[model samples]
Target: MSSLILGIESSCDETGVALVRLPDGGAVPQLLSHALHSQIDMHRAYGGVVPELASRDHIRRVLPLTEHVLKESGTTLQDVDVVAFTRGPGLAGALLVGAGVACALGAALDRPVLGVHHLEGHLLSPFLSEDPPEFPFIALLVSGGHTQLMRVDGVGDYAILGETIDDAAGEAFDKSAKLMGLPYPGGPELSRLAEGGDPEAFKLPRPLLHSGDLDFSFAGLKTAVLTQAKKLGDDLEARKADLAASTQAAIVDVLVRKTLTALKDTGMRRVVVAGGVGANKLLRAQLNAACAKRQIRVHYPELHLCTDNGAMIAMAAAMRLQAGREQAEKTYAFDVKPRWPLDSLK
Candidate 1:
């Protein structure tokens, strides 16, 4: 009595479609196949996301990608038992594209539809990895617009330990990269440029390094990067790599120290890092070294699954249904939550 679940994710600039098989027995759901299309190239020209363009692109990509996934999986739309989609905390127009498509598909097939929280998809993404984690681990979620530490006991059981007060770690990287005149989607570019530079060449601020709490603040770090760039007016180009490295170092230092603090406070040796920033090589290297020193276990989403993807959405929906935490409804009526809070998913 296995069921095929179709998932769609269009919360932002990426259009992702995936199919997952939910087992009737007590076992993990298996990913059948997935397809993704990133609007990075298009957004690059604009230097950032354009909401209307994003929504339009999502509309064009979702169906084709869904077809691609089904073909790769050797499945048909008629075989799908449920349709799942990202419903909130994203661009309003972009979200509607996914929700509308998912609900319409569900209605046409006379199947149930489930709307998943975007962050929950990220939180549960690592389950798709070869080495999945056990329950009750500390989760460090970092991305372009988010940074938080959470205590995850199980599906739908999450407690926020700390979160960003202003900018997130990803913003620190991207903004700093921009200040250095790097291209759009600056974080990865900055990381690459940093490879040849001395991380200690420039002194950058580690905001809230000792806030006595788990909360984070990276807004000031962005300002510091701007100040440094201006100070190097004539030599900025030659020293850009060093600045990038320094900025990355400062951000990583704060993230690692705060994560360690959270680990110590919770006495949990296992940690899960999710979201786009989880793909950062330096962060992974530093975190690995730090965790190994403490003899702690760290789990991550497969590299391909680190970013926003429909696979995570499908897996999350399947798990939620299996856990009996939520139900797919026949009513296809839907709305998007562009500002939904993760903790509020409580």
Candidate 2:
């Protein structure tokens, strides 16, 4: 009999539900069905995600998305062997929506429930693809709220090598885009505008390039963009694309160099890039090139997978279930940890 897992993800503004069929003997898991509802448009006006709004929206969308996943997968609730949901490192209200729904469903079906770390979902996302990386690799997680270098020894073993002291890479991109007059969620938009502009047009500082540690800092670079924008005065709008391009180049340069350094320091040839900034074209291209040049391999989830989604949450849950990490209790009570730590798991 095949084990079907239903995964719920509402860590942020996206509500994702997915089903995965895990077979015996370590065969590759199959994606049965997945559904996602993005609250991007709803929060776009605010220039960034609003926590209260995000929580409210998750409550509205989680149930429908779960139903959609079941219908799309052609499976009934009884067929699901386990229910999994993102449990922490996210907005309290948002995490509760997923946890509440998943626990309720697990109780109704009399199945085991598991709470997965949001970043672990990201770390294991590459497994959803054709050729996944093996264990004991380096991971550079650069998202809107975090920037860290980690050593992944196994499914539940993670060691942090270094992290950011201030603003994350994604936050820097968004802030720089704001300075350049781009709309909210400005990271991607800023990259698009940069396509036609010259990366060498402006000289932006690459913060912490030679800090002699794995830690990163983009706060200074963001300020540099502000200085440049202010210097341009009334013509800032006209030179927006150029400014965007320069800012992106500086960011990518720092990320690539730092990641390569991590790889070299650890002697780990395999590196996986995760989180929102993982979708940046320049970063991908430059990192790919750098890895190739050093005969090192780098892996990334597909563009859609790079951002927050349900499939990864489900997949990671399946892995944990197979490993017999922990089983769910017969409790409908669930609470969210808004500031949970990944290292706290081990």
For each candidate in the order shown, give its overall lDDT on alpha carbons. Answer: 0.94, 0.88
State how far residue 266 of model 1 sits from its true place (Å). 0.7
Q: For residues 223-312, what per-residue lDDT tens digits would candidate 1 score against the true structure?
A: 999999999999999998898889999999998899999999999989999999999988899999999999999999999999999999
- Give a tens-digit lDDT track for model 2, residues 1-346: 6799899999998999999998988776778888889999999988888989998998888888888989988888999988889998898888988999999998888888888899988888888877788888999898998998999888888898888889999999999988888998889899999998889989999988999988999999999999999999998888888999999999889888888889999999899999989989899999999899989888888788888888998889888766666565666677777787776765
Poorly placed runs, candidate 1 (over 4 Å): none
**lDDT at 63, model 2:** 83
Best by TM-score: 1
TM-score of model number 1: 0.99
